[model samples]
Target: MNAREVNTLNIVGGRVIDPTTDADGRLVDIHVVDGRIAVIVEAGGALPSADSVLDASNAVVSPGFVDLHTHLREPGREESETIETGSRAAALGGFTAVVAMPNTDPAQDSRAVVEFVREQGRRAGLCEVVPSGCITVGRAGEQLVPYAELMKSGVTLFTDDGNGVQDPLLMRRAFEYSSDLGVTMAQHCEVSRLTAGAVMHEGSCCSHLGLPGWPSIAEELMVHRDIELVRITGGRLHVLHVSTARSVEMIRAAKADGLSVTAEVTPHHFTLDDESLRSFDPVFKVNPPLRTMADIEALKAGLRDGTIDAIATDHAPHADHLKEQPLDTAPPGMLGLETAFALSVGELGMDLRSVLACLSWNPARIAGIADRHGRPVAVGEPANLAVLDPGVGWTVDRRRLASKSRNTPYEGRSVTGRVRHTVLNGRAVVIDQVAQR
Candidate 1:
């Protein structure tokens, strides 16, 4: 992977979409030298010396995607996922970086957990895996985790993701500390009081299935509370995996008020609905469980008109044993890394740049990895990119996914668009819909 030994590798005949530079996804040729973009010349234009070349003739080349939330399941639950497996899945999903959630075995509330996850990602050498810190001691949601200590260890976002901080005063104090430390506080946005023992979204669909429902208020109430807290503390608040219509309206109004607030919606939220849960498939089970189609439309609208800041995968993975239990008793989650891009393009129906903004640049800025990972395709930039065939249509075969967990609801479902190639640091980790390494 050394650059000096390999002088240059040219990526030609691709549509370059560098939103930062107004590339606008036009067809061009990109030359990589010493692991950096040497030049982006016109198609068939003069190119630098090269030992290799990637044919991206039918692909759309854009900055690599950054997942604002990914559960790598390392240090605690390797049976479900590891840094290596998750990163490979991410690469296949057109992601260059992922923020590993802190709710691991030892819980990334301490520096030991934080450093171990970062080192593991480095050792795996698959994708940039940034570790998040817990907002409470041991993620117990009781006492706050040492935010200052975690920040010192390179942690950027703090959350007890599996559970929201139930104590309003404690959450308020967390925001106060977050403002001083300059790290973002991301909330899972569910009121435990309302969601206790609930299996799916509370709605007509849930009533018909006779399943206990997780009311929209469970999520919206917390979102509403957090937005008000952000206004008071002036701390950066990022709402994670928002799943309800009212939640979107709350975030939209907060933005309208010019608050320092940002939010992300999972692909499932915008694409699927609670109706999927009627099958009793645990794969459809998730926190902030899938809402009704009306909610789905609102989520899509939020993404379409820019009210939503990013499209986070919330790529939670679970072991088969965990997910095999009855739908009501099973742990909530599903595989996402390998399906985010296609799902977005197929369901959202927006231009490529807007989609990439949610998948790439916008999330990078939120995760604080913008400088190296989300840059445009041009001279003097790192060769981190995804080449996708925007018009390709395909069905998701869960068995073919790179993740150890196969809990995706999209199995056997036809979807449009596909990631043809993914280049990370000048190497084609994925080429022609296949992972190289």
Candidate 2:
């Protein structure tokens, strides 16, 4: 496909909810030509004959979502996920782009690896896959990678996701070095010393189950340290997968103080609690383990009040048998890309616009991908949009997911809201809840 070519597509009779253009709740028809929004008229308005038409009555037409964090496990771990499968899952979740994490086998520290990942995403053609750089060499936590080099290679976000930068001094220097690079330092936010052998959140749940606890303090300590570091270094910091009450409060306070700090919370953190661990399902296991109901409420409040900027999926995928291992032995992650929209809508208790903002626009700005993604639904803009049914309810089936792995914790859970059609670059990658590819 050429850069300026797309099938003539028309999305008819849908409520357009674009916060950027003050078009929320307006019934509009979107026309796409050559991959750009050619016109938006009232529902049933006449227009040029389109080869493709999607009846979106009672649905929502909004900017396609952008996930700030996603593990596309390629270049080494294709057994878990590749850019193509992950992009398919993302498209089904209404995401037009996902920032690919740097925790792969070789770790995306070099420009060669970074370009390869970006090129693979291009080949997939499902969604935009933006590669992130490692904060440290090979994400080893001891030495810093070349930020200028990575930035020139088009990576604006950097992180050591599976492992937080354990050394405070090293983290401080990372922020300092980022001062001139115009990159954001994203932290996984676990103090390694505090979470050495932990499996679940520290609380009565762990005590009752006789399991090692991953305490909230381990996350809060790093949150506090990174905030102070940003305060001093005047560099931007993005806290990834924040899961604790105190961590939320500290991030709220840091933002109030006018620091350039942003944060994201995973759907699993807000939708499930540590009590799920009582069932001994390794699928519930995650790096930032699920916390108490109190923490879930706090996270919901954070999203409601804008303390947390984006609702990232953390979209970690593991092989079937890997997640089927005993809790203590299994890898800590769960499939998220396909279930995030349903979980967020049914659980957040917020209005449609705010919820979509957290899922789309907010994360787009954070990931620095607002130019091509998360833009308003209007004429002359790229037609990257998600047609959503906010009131539809469905149950998740792990076997039917587009992801290469089947480790979703939301399996069998009933949820509302679904991505009906996902139009990426003006072509329907997902139509009627199915990936066209």
Candidate 3:
């Protein structure tokens, strides 16, 4: 399918809530031409004609979401998800951009892999798919990837997502190297030694179920290590999938101490708990496995208080054969992109603007794509926006999701707030909840 070339579009009668520009849910009409915002008029002000009009009544129009962590699983694992399929899922979920993790079959540690990912995204043309480079060569954690070369190829964030850099000296060197290159390093924050046989959080649920437990310290220890490393090297660090109360406290302290650290919490981390593992279902399984209810409260507080910088989906998708295995044998992950907004709005108790801050602008800044995505809704900014109905409720049905995988943990759950339209570079990739291509 060819990319939809939208020349002009007008989003009408929506409550514009651009936190970047402080629009604050004001009723306005936004006009776009040639892939850029042409004008933003008040609700009753005169409007310009356009090739297409999206009626956004009773909706909150804001910058399209930017996910800091998304596993596209392409370059090898096409049966699970390809760049095209993942970008389509992102658009339908109101995302304008997603950072593709570098844990593919061959691993995205080289310029060829990085360029291949970017070119595929350009061909998809649904959303901006930024490729994250692997911190270690082939994600082996033994040696670092070619940072300067990858950075030259436009890769900004680096991570060995499935595995954290375990060697302190190696990680410090990575920090030093990345600092010089002016790029950011993201850590998955798990100490493999402590989680060798773990399947879920080490808590009452795991004890009762006789399942191997993944202790919070496994993640917190790494978080602490990375914080100190960032403090020592003054290199920017992003902690991924923060799942413990202590982890949040440590991040808060790190920020107070002026360390260049940013952290993200997954929707599942803030919404679900280890008790979900009691069902013995694999859908509840995820890396940095869901923690206790106390951890959930802490994550929520961190988000509300600004300690947690963004709400990334970590949208890991696995085929049925892999995801449907017995709890101890199944891979850890869950479908998130499609239900992220609803889960945040219905579960976090945060206002719509605050939610967008985490889902949109903050994440865009973290992923280094703020220039185009997460831009203010004003003249001259790129027309990447999402029209969301904050009051509407919908039940999550796995069969209806855009991703090829059906491993959503929120299946059958009902939640308020849904994306009504998503405009990507002036093109209506999604209108009235339907994907355009």
Candidate 4:
């Protein structure tokens, strides 16, 4: 069941929705040859011969999804996830490419580490894995990594995820350096001082549960600081997993101010609230902890109004033993890649077009992979595509997921819009909701 390159594939009877080329839900047939889209014709138009044919009837075909933030956990925590398993999960979730975060055991600060991650993904043969370099050496938040060397290895995004750079001066200098290198700095907007001993959102929920609280101001402060830093250094900045109403407001204002900034919101931040903490489930314990329903409303508003450019799954995974501990002692994170698209469509209630913009094109632009992964499904384009049955419904089951981790927060919840098939490089990686390898 290994993913081998296919010479030709004929996808029939799907509604093509390529936002980049303004193809709005037109019934069409896509023909792929030699890992590229050979032609696209009307549904009932002239046909092309192929080695394989996929019936995409009643499905929506679009450019494959691109996740700007994904934690693959290779070269470190293989007990939780690896590049192969994560890529399987991603293909099933309709994602053809993911930006592997640099928070591994050895850390992806060196060109050697970044190349290892990329090569491992290639051997896995499931999806395109883009490695991000750590903004600071060893992710220590002090010395900057060899940005130019990492860039030579094809790393376009840098971040010290799981921890923001605490020193303002260091961050400003990093921004200045990255600006000159023409790379984007993605920030995990958290102030360690404010979030100390925090398990859930610093709100009535934490108070009622008698637990430590992570305040919204903690994330907002970093967002505001980074926005100002972007203004000063003239560097590209991307705020990751924005969780609060004020954070959304600040990003909206920053966008209006013409700052070179983009922001992302996770599905959990918009779909679930801190009230889920009443059960004291460690699955709900996430960094930049879940906020109130008011914050959810604001995040949705930001998505609708174009304040949030992408809906990235901060797809963190944890081993069952680690995640099963008490909420206060457990690590913060949850499985996301397998459920991101379904939750984004079912919970946000946005049109399919807007959802794809957040899930596909916008994130591709942010990761600088739009040239290959998120191109329009047209003649001569690379054949990375997802065929989605938007009318289908399914419930979350952690045991059925492709990731090695079983830490999904949406277990047993019903969701709309299942991925019928995923095609990567003219090869079907997932068919009929099943992973090929």
CA lDDT of each prediction against the hidden true structure: 0.88, 0.92, 0.92, 0.92
Please write out the lDDT profile of model 1 over residues 1-437, one tens digit for every residue: 55457666778899888775453657799988766898888888888767878888978899999999999999889999999999999999999899999889999989988999999997877678899999899888889888888878878888899898889999999998779778899999888988878999998998999898899988888899899999999888999998988889999999999998888999998988988886888989999899988998999999988889999998988888899999878989888999999999988988888999999999998887888888878789998899888789999998899998888989999988899888888878788878887
Q: Model 2 clash tally?
A: 0
- Candidate 1, TM-score vs. the true structure? 0.97
Clash statistics: count for each candidate: 0, 0, 0, 0
Clash list (residue pairs), candidate 4: none
User: Cα deviation of 202 in candidate 3 (Å)?
Assistant: 0.7
Clashing pairs in 1: none
Q: Which runs of model 1 end up more than 4 angstroms from their true locations? A: 1-7, 21-24
Candidate 2 residues lying further than 4 Å off, grouped into runs, are: 1-6, 21-24
What TM-score, to 2 decimals, does candidate 2 have? 0.98
TM-scores, all candidates, are 0.97, 0.98, 0.98, 0.98
lDDT tens digits by residue: candidate 2, 1-437: 57655479999999999876453678988889978999889888886779899889999998999999999999899999999999999999999999999999899999999999999998999999999999999999999999999887789999999999999999999999898778899999999899888999999989999999999999999999999999999989999999999999999999999999999999999999999988898989999999999999999999999999999999999998888787888999988999999889888988889988999989988898889899988899999999999889999999999999999998888999999999999999999988998
Off by over 4 Å in 3: 1-6, 21-23
**Could you tell me which 10 consecutive residues in candidate 4 have the lowest summed lDDT?**
16-25
Better of 2 and 4 by lDDT: 2
